[model samples]
Target: MATRCLRYGSLAFLVAQDTALVLLMRYSRSHATGEMYLASTAVCCMEVLKLCVCVGMLYAGEARGSISGLVNVFRREFLEKPSEVLRLAVPSFLYLLQNNLLYFALSNLRATPYKVTYNLKILTSALFSVTMLGQKLSKRKWLSLIALFVGVTVVQSDNHKSDSDAPHPETGLGYQTLGFLAVVAAAFTSGFCGVYQQKILQAGKTNMWVRNAQMGLTSVCLGVVSTIVKDRQAIQERGFFQGYTRLVWTVIIIQAVGGLNVAFILKYADNILKGFAAAFSTVASCVLEMAIMHFRPTATFLLGGALINVAAYCYNTPGRKDGNKLPR
Candidate 1:
C-alpha cells in the first residue's frame, strides 16, 4: 500500500513538474531571453546534473564491494563493451534534437496551442512501437489515434484563425509554420528514441541510471557543439548567459529536474503511463496559461482538448490482459 501511494505521489509530482517546465520555457522565451543557444546550454547543464546525480545514487546504493571494484566495473563496461552504451546513447543524442526543436516551437506558439499540438506524440509513439517493437495495435487503438489527430487538427486550425486576427499576422504565419514543422519533427524523433530506449533496456543488464548518465554525456557533448555552431553570432554580441534573469534560471533548473524525473519514469513506468502524464500535463498547462498569462481558451480549443483527452484515455487503457505486453 505504501509503495503504491509513493508511486502515485511520484506520478502526480511528475505531471506538475512537466507542466511547470513548459510554462517556464514559454516565459523564458517571451520575457528573459530568446536565444536558443543559451537555452541549449541550460539543457547541457541539465544533462551534467543528471549524470552527477545518477553517479551519486549508484555509488551510494547500487554499488557493491569497494570503491575500486565499482570503478573497475565501470571501466570494463564503458571501455570493454562500449557498444552497449552507444546503442542507447546514439538514439539519445538524436532525441536531443527533438528537445531543442521543442524549445523553438514553444517560443513561437502560445502555451495552450503548443500543448495541444504536442499531444500528437502519443500517436507517433504508438506507430513507432508497432513498427519497431513488433507490437500490434487493436482496431480501437487505431480509432483512438485517428481521433487524437483530428483533435489536434481542430485545435491547430483554431489557433491559426486566432493568429490571423492579430496584428502582424504575416509574421505569425512564418513563425507558426516553422514551429509546426519543428514540432512534427520532434514528435517523430521522440517516438523513435523512446522505442529505441525501451529496446535497449530490455536487451541488457545495464543499469538504468548508467544508461541515463551515458545519454546525458552524449547530449552534453552534442549540445555544446551545436550551441557553438548555432549561437556564435549571438554569443559574440551579447555573451553567453547575457539576459539571464531569475526566471530564466528557474526555467533551467526545472528543465533539469524534469529530465531526471523522466529518466526515473522511463525506468519504472510503462509507455502508457508516460503518455498519460504528457496528456495530463497538457491539461495542466492550459490551466496554468489561463491563470498566469490571462489567456482565454476558445470554445473550439476546449472541444478539441476534450476530444484529445478522451482519445488518449482510449488509446492507453488496456483492452485485454494480453495487451499489457505491448509496451515491453
Candidate 2:
C-alpha cells in the first residue's frame, strides 16, 4: 500500500507538472497563427513518450514475472479468444476519445475556469456509473457528489473576475457555460469507459502486459490516423526532432512516465477511481498553478479546493460502491 500510494503520488506530481507546462506553453502560443499545429505536435510528442514509457513498464513487469509474465499472452489468450481482445479494445477506444476530447476542450480554455468547471466531471461520472454500469452509490457517495457540486459552484464564483484586468482570457459566462457542458460530456464518456475497462480487466485470467502493449499500439495507430486526418501537413511539418525544445521534450517524457502508472492503475482498479484520480490531480495542478501565479490564494479558492479534495476522497474510499456494475 505504501508503494502504491507513493506511485500514485509521483504520478500526480508528474501530471501536475506536465499540465502546468502545457497550459503555460500553450498560453504563450495562444496568439500565434499556428496554434493548432503547435498543439497537435505537442500532443503527439506526449503520446510518443507515453508509448515508450508503457513499453518500459511492461518489460519491467515481465522481468519480475508478474503482470507481464505472459509476454505471449496475446497469442495464447487473444489469438484464441479474439472476442476478448475486442472487448478490451472497445473500452480503451472510448477512453481514448474521452481523453483527447477533454484535452481539446482544455486547450481551448484558460486554466482557472477550466479547473472550476472540470469538477462537474465527478457528477457525470457517477451518473454514467449508475445508469450504464448499474453500479450502486452509497448515501455517502451521494453526499460527496453534492459537496462536489457546491465546491464547483464556489470555485466558479471565484473565477468570475474581469478578464480585462487579467493577462489571459477572461472566460465569460457564455464560454464557461459551454466549456462546462463539453467537460460534462467528456466526463460521462470517460465514466462509462472506466466501468467497461474494469469489466474487461476482470473478465478472465488475462495478461495485463499484453493488454497494455496492444493498447499502446492501438493508441499510436489511432492517434496517428486521427492526427493525419485532422491536419497531415501540420503533423509532418512538426517533425519529431524539430517540434519541441529540450525542456518541452523533458516534460513529455515525464508525462509519459506518469501516464504509464495511471494506465497500470486503470488496469487493476475501477474507472471511476481513475476519474477521481484525474480530478484530484487537476486540483493538485491547480494548486501548483496558483503558487506560480505568485499571488495569494483567496479564501474562497482554498476552501473550495479543500472541498473538492474531500469529495474526491469520499468517492475513492474502499467498499464504497462507485455506482458501477459489472457482469457477474
Candidate 3:
C-alpha cells in the first residue's frame, strides 16, 4: 500500500510540476515589461542548483552526515573514476541544449502551442529507445508514434499564419519561426538524451544521486561555457542576475527541482503512467493557457491535442498481454 501511494504521489507531483513550469515560463517570457532575463544564465543556474542538490542527496544517503565520508565517496566516484563521469557528458550537454530550446520556444510561442509541439519528444525518444536500447515495440507503439508525428505536424500548422490572420499577442514579436525551429531541435535532443541516460542508469547499480551529480557537474561546466560564449557581452553590461525577479526565480526553482522529480518517477513508477501524467499536464496547460494567457485555441489545435493524447496512450501502454490501464 505504501509503495502504491508513493507511486501515485510522485506521478501526481510530476503532472502538476510540469504543467506549472510550462505556464509560468510562458507568462514570464511573453508578459514581461522590463529587461528580460537571459535564458542561458537561467539554465546555468539551474544546473548549479541541481548539482548542489544531488551532492547533498548523495551525502545524506552515502555519507551518513559525515563530511569526511562524503568527501571520500565523492572522490571515489567523481575524481577517482573519471571515466564514469565522462560517460555522462553527452547526455548532460544535450539536456542543457534542450532546456535552452524550451525557453526559446516558450518565449516566442504561447503556452498552448509550445506544450503541444513539445510532445514530439515522445516519438523521438521511442525511436532512440528502440535503436539504442534494443527495445521492441508492438504494432500499437509504431502506429502511435506515427500518429504522434502527424499530430505534432498538425500542431505546427497553427504556427504559420497568413497575412490575413493577425498575429497573436504572444507572438507579436515576430520570432515564431525561430521559436518553432528551436523546439523541433529540442525534441530531437530530448529523444536521444533520454535513451542515452536510461542506458547509463541501467548499466550499473551505482547510486542514482551520484550519477546525477556527475551529469550536473558536467552540465554546469558546459552551461558556464555556453553562457560566456553567447552572453559574455550581455553579462558584462548587465549582471548575471540582472532582470531577474521573483517570478524568474520561481521558474528556475521549478526547472531545477522538476528534473530531480522526474528521476524519482522513473525510479519508482512505470513509464506508461509517466506518459499519462505528461498527457494530463499537456491538457492542464491547454486549459491554463486559455484562462491565464487568453489563448484562443483553434479547431485544428484541439484536434491535434486529441490525437497527441491518444498517441501517448498507445505508445506508452504495453501490449495486450500486459494489462495496465490509465488511472481513473
Candidate 4:
C-alpha cells in the first residue's frame, strides 16, 4: 500500500509542480514589475536551495541526525566512491542546461506554444529510456504517446490561431523562432537527464537522499559558475538578489524544490510516467492560463484535451504490461 501510494503520490506531485512552477514563473517574469530578476541568478539560488535541502534530508535519513554518521556517509559516498559524484554530474549538468535553455525558450515563446513544443521531450525521453535503461514500451503505449503529442498540438493550434488573429497583451512572448529551437534543445536535454537520473536513483545501492545530495552539490557548483559568467555585469551593477520580490521568491522556491519532487518520482516511478505527468501539466496549465484571461477555449481545444484524456487511459489500462521486450 505504501509503495503504491508513493508511486501515485509522486506522480501527482509532478503534475502539480510542473503546472505551478511554470505559471509562477510566467507571473514573476512578465506581470510583476519592479526590476525583473535575472533568470541566471534564480537558477543559482535554486541550486543552492536544493543542495541545502538535500543535505538536510541526507543528514536526517542516512546519518540518523548524527554529525559523525553524516561524515561517515560522506566518506562512503563521496570519498571512497568519488566517482559517484561525477556520475551525478552528468544528469546535473544536463538538467542545468535544460533549465537555462528554458529561460531562453519561455522568453521567446508564449505560454501555450511553449508547453506544446516542450512535449517533444516526451519523445526524446522515450528514446533515451529504451537505449539507456532497457525499458520496454508496448505498441499500445506508443500509440498513447502519439495521441498525447497530437492532442496537445491540436489543443494549442486553436489558441495559436486565436493569438494571431488578436494579439492580446500576452506575457512571456518573445521571438518565436529562437524560442522554438531553445525549447527543442531543452526537450532533448530533459529526456537524457531524466532517464539517466532514473537509472541511478533506482539502483538501490545508495540512499535516494544521498544521491540527491551528490547531484545537488554538483548542480550548485555548476550553477554558480554559470551565473557568474552570464550575469557578471548585472550582478556588479545591481546585486545578486536585485529585482527580487515575494512572488519571485515563490517562483525560486517552487523551481528549486522541484529536484526533490522529481527525485521521489524517479525513485518510485520511471521516465515515461513522468512524461505523462508533464503532459498533463501542460494541458492543465494552458487551461488555467485561459481561465485567467477569461478566454473561452475553442472546440479544437476541447477535442484535443479529450484525446489526451483518452490517451492517458489507454496508456494505463489495467493488467497490461508497459511494452514488448525490445532487443537492446
Candidate 5:
C-alpha cells in the first residue's frame, strides 16, 4: 500500500511539475518586459539547482544514517572507475542539448504548438526503447503510438490555424522550418537520452541521487562551454541573471525541480510511464490555460486530448494471449 501510494504520489508530482514547466516557459517567453534569456544560461542555472539538490539529498541521507559511510561515495567511485561515471555523464549531455533546443523551439513557436510537436518524443522514445533497450512492443502498442501521433498532428494543425489568425502571424517559412527542425532534433535527443540513461541506471546499483549529481556536474560544464560559445557577447553586455524578474526566477525554480524529479522518475519508472505523464501534463496545460489565461479550447484540442488519453490507455493496458487485446 505504501509503495502504491508512493507511485501515485510521484506520478502526480510529475504531472504538476511538467504543467508548471510549460506555463513558466510560456510566461518567460511572452513577458512584456522584453526580457530575453540565453538558453545556455538557463540550462546552466537548472543544472546548478539540480546539483545542489543532489548534494543536499546525499547529506540528508547521511544524517539519517542510511548512507553513513558513503559520504564520499561519488568521489571514490569516480577515482576508482572514472570511466563508469563518464559512461553515464557523457550520454547525459544529450539532455542538455535537447533542453537548449527546446528553449529555442519554444521561443519560435507558441506554447500549444510546441507541446503538440513535442509529443512526438513519445514515439521517438518507444523506437529507442525497442532498438537500444532491446525491448519488444505488441501491435497494440504500435497502434497506440500511431493514434498518439495522429492526435498530436491534429492539435498542431489547429494551432497553426490559430497562429494564422493572429495579427502578427509568423509567415516566415525559414523561421517555421527552423523551429520544426529544432523540435524534431529535440525529440530525437530526448528519446536517445532517456533510453541511454535508463541503460545506465540498470547497469549498476548506483543511487539515483549520485547519478543526478554526476549528470548535473557534467551538464553544468557543458552549459558553461555552450554559453561561452553561443552567448558570450550577450552575457558580457547584460550579465548573467540580467532581466531576471520574480516570474523568471519562478521559471528557473520550476525548471530545476522538474529536472530533479525526472531523474527520480526515470530511476523508479520507465520511459513509457514518463511519456504518459507528459501527455497528461499537456492536456492539463490546455485546461489550465483555459481557466487562467482565458484561452478557449478548440474542438480539435478537445478531440486531440481525448484521443491522446485513449492512446495512453491502449499503450499501458496488457495484451491478451489470444490477440493484441487491452487488459480486462
Candidate 6:
C-alpha cells in the first residue's frame, strides 16, 4: 500500500536523478549559471514546501500534551526543548552547504567515478566520530573500512577504463577530474554534518518531521542567498522561470521527493548506514549512464560495484547486538 508505493517511488526517483544528472553532465558545455541556480532553487522550494506539509500534519489539531499520535515520537518531545531546537540549526545549515557543492560536482562529472569517490564519506564520518566526538569503533569497523577502500579502488579503475573511450569535445577530463575532487570534498563535509546531526538527535530527541522542517528551511535560506550572491538579477529575469516547461518542473519536484526520502532515512538510522543507502542512488545513476551511452556494464564494473555495496553494508551495520558482537 503506502509503504510499497513509497518504496517503488523512491527507486524510480533515483533512476530519474541519475538520468537528469547524466543529462546535465552532457550539457555542461552549454550550462548557464542561471539555469543551474533555478534548477537547484526548484529543489529547495519543494523541500521546504513538503517539510511544511509534514509538520502541519503533525500539529493540525493537537494541543499541548494532547498526544495526537504522530508517526515520529521525537517531534512531540522536541517541542519542549527550545534551546535544543535552536542548536540543531547549525548542522542543518551545514547540510545545505554540502549538498549545493555536491550538486555542482554532479553537474560537472559523470556518474560512476563520482559515486565510487563518494564512498569515502563513510571513512571520513567514522574518523570524525572517533576524533571529534570521542566515539569508539569496534575492530570490525576497521576491517570494513579496508574492504570499502579496496572495493572503491576497483570500481574507480573499472570506470576509468570505460570512460576512457567516450568522446568529449567541450567538457574533457580536466573538468571531470575537478568534479571528482569537489564531490569527494562534499562527501567529507556532508559526513561531518551528519555526525553533528546525529549528536543533536541523541541530545534533543527531535523527530524526523521536526528535523526535516529545520533542515529544509536552512537549505531554502542558503539556496536563496547563494542564488542572490551568484546572480543578483537572475531571480528577476523570466528566463529562469520559462526556461523549461511543466515537465521539467515535475522532474525537479520529484527530486525533492527523493530528498525527503533521504532525509527520512537519515533521521532514524545511523548516519553511516544512511550514507550507504545513498550509494543506491549512485548505482542507479551509473546504470542509467551506461544505458544512455549504449555501453553495457562490464563484468569488472558490476562486480566491483557489488563488492563496494557489500563493504558499505558491513561498515554501516551495528558492530554489536544485544548478546553478541560481530567478529572483528
The model with the greatest TM-score is 3
For 115-161, candidate 2 gives per-residue lDDT tens digits of 55566766876777688666788788888899988987787567543
By the lDDT metric, which is better: model 4 or model 5? 4
Give one digit per residue, the lDDT tens place, for model 6 in 139-177.
767788888778767766664534433333322333555
Writing each residue's lDDT as its tens digit, candidate 3 over 1-328 gives 8767877888899889999999998777866768788899999999999999998987788998889999998888989989888888998989999999898887777777777887877777767877987777777778888998898888888743322233335335437777789888998897787677766775678887988999999999999999999899989998899779999999999999988876766556544445557666889998886787667788888888899998887766667664433223
- Steric collisions counted per model: 0, 2, 0, 2, 0, 0
lDDT of each: 0.72, 0.59, 0.80, 0.76, 0.73, 0.60
Which stretches of candidate 2 lie above 4 Å from their native place?
A: 1-37, 56-74, 77-81, 131-134, 157-179, 236-243, 267-269, 294-306, 313-328
Put down candidate 1 lDDT per residue, 1-328, tens digits, no spaces.
6545545666788789878888887766654324333656666666667767776766765566368765865686667877776775677677678878887787677777887888887888888878887778788888989999999888877754343223222123226767777788887787777777777765667787777766776777787888788777777887877666777678777777777766655655555566677888888898888898766888998999999999988877757643544333
lDDT of candidate model 4 versus the reference:
0.76
TM-score of each model, paired residue for residue: 0.87, 0.71, 0.91, 0.87, 0.87, 0.70
**Over the full model, what C-alpha lDDT does candidate 6 score relative to the true structure?**
0.60
Off by over 4 Å in 6: 1-40, 61-86, 132-134, 153-174, 237-242, 295-307, 316-328
Candidates 3 and 5: which is better by TM-score? 3
Q: After superposition, how far is residue 40 of candidate 6 from its true place, in Å?
A: 4.3
lDDT of candidate model 5 versus the reference: 0.73
Which ranges of candidate 5 are over 4 A from the true structure? 62-71, 159-177, 322-328
Stretches off by above 4 angstroms in model 1 are: 1-9, 33-37, 63-70, 160-174, 320-328
